[model samples]
Target: MSVDLSGAHWFKSTRSAAGNDCVEIAHLDGGRVGVRDSKNPHGGALVFTPLEWDAFLSVARGGEFDRP
Candidate 1:
């Protein structure tokens, strides 16, 4: 299903530095989520379903992306 992201209210992590090189997230309708780069707000976003977002968060919290 295609989501209308024209009005997405994107926000980034508060911990992000002032350099503007961070990822932004927006809560879309129908329990969907959108992610994009702060450097280019109009560059489009990667959409994710609610379940996929949950699974991603779970793995992220588990240090899956941490350096070995």
Candidate 2:
């Protein structure tokens, strides 16, 4: 389902460095989540369902994205 990310409070990762080259995310309605680049707040955002977010985070924390 689509969600309106506008006005949604976006935050950068606490692990990010001084330079803001990271992405931001915000929770949305309808069990959805919004994600966008911090450098481009007005840019388009990608929406993901709650389940999708959970699965993505799980994989991320499991070192699925770790370089070999």
Candidate 3:
């Protein structure tokens, strides 16, 4: 699925530090989500479908990615 992100209003998490180093996210049309690196706006991005995004959020909230 090709999702256009040219006009995406990307934003970082509020927990992010006040700097250029962070991840940015944009809620796109069709319940899609966009993600990219703040330090490289022009760099490539990852687009997630609604289901994928939800599953990711579930895992995240479950702390599946917590540091050991």
Candidate 4:
């Protein structure tokens, strides 16, 4: 679960507006993904397995996380 993010090439969604508040993501080795707060790059990251990341993207694209 401890993925080294030192060389991570973090980037935010292109759909995101030009602002400071956002989350950054990096595609890691072995198909894993890394996510971290843009405001705190050195804080830490949440690593997700390929399957888990894919499932999350599916729900996200389906608006499952949309506010009611």
Per-residue lDDT of 1-68 in model 3, one digit per residue for the tens?
A: 77778899999999999998999999999999999999999999999999999999999999999999
Best-fitting candidate, scored by lDDT:
3
Q: What is the lDDT of residue 14 in candidate 3?
A: 97
User: Per-residue lDDT for 36 in model 3?
Assistant: 96
Q: Write the per-residue lDDT of candidate 2 for residues 1-68, one digit (tens) a residue.
A: 55666679998889999887999889887768889988888988999989999999999999999999
lDDT of each: 0.92, 0.87, 0.95, 0.92
Give candidate 1's root-mean-square deviation (CA, Å). 0.9
User: What lDDT score is found at residue 6 in candidate 3?
Assistant: 87
lDDT of 4 by residue, 23-66 (tens): 99999999999999988888979999999999999999999999
Better of 2 and 4 by TM-score: 4
Against the true structure, what is each candidate's TM-score? 0.93, 0.89, 0.94, 0.91
Q: Count the backbone clashes (under 3 Å) in each candidate.
A: 0, 0, 0, 0
Give the TM-score ranking, best first.
Answer: 3, 1, 4, 2
Per residue, candidate 1 scores C-alpha lDDT tens digits across 1-68 of: 67899988989889988888999999999889999998898887899999999999999999999999
**Candidate 2 segments whose C-alpha is farther than 4 A from its true place:** none
What is the Cα-based lDDT of residue 63 in candidate 2? 100
For model 2, where is the 10-residue window of minimal lDDT? 1-10
TM-score, structure 2 vs. true: 0.89
Q: How far out, in Å, is residue 63 in model 3?
A: 0.9
Q: Which stretches of candidate 1 lie over 4 Å from their true place?
A: none
The best candidate in terms of TM-score: 3
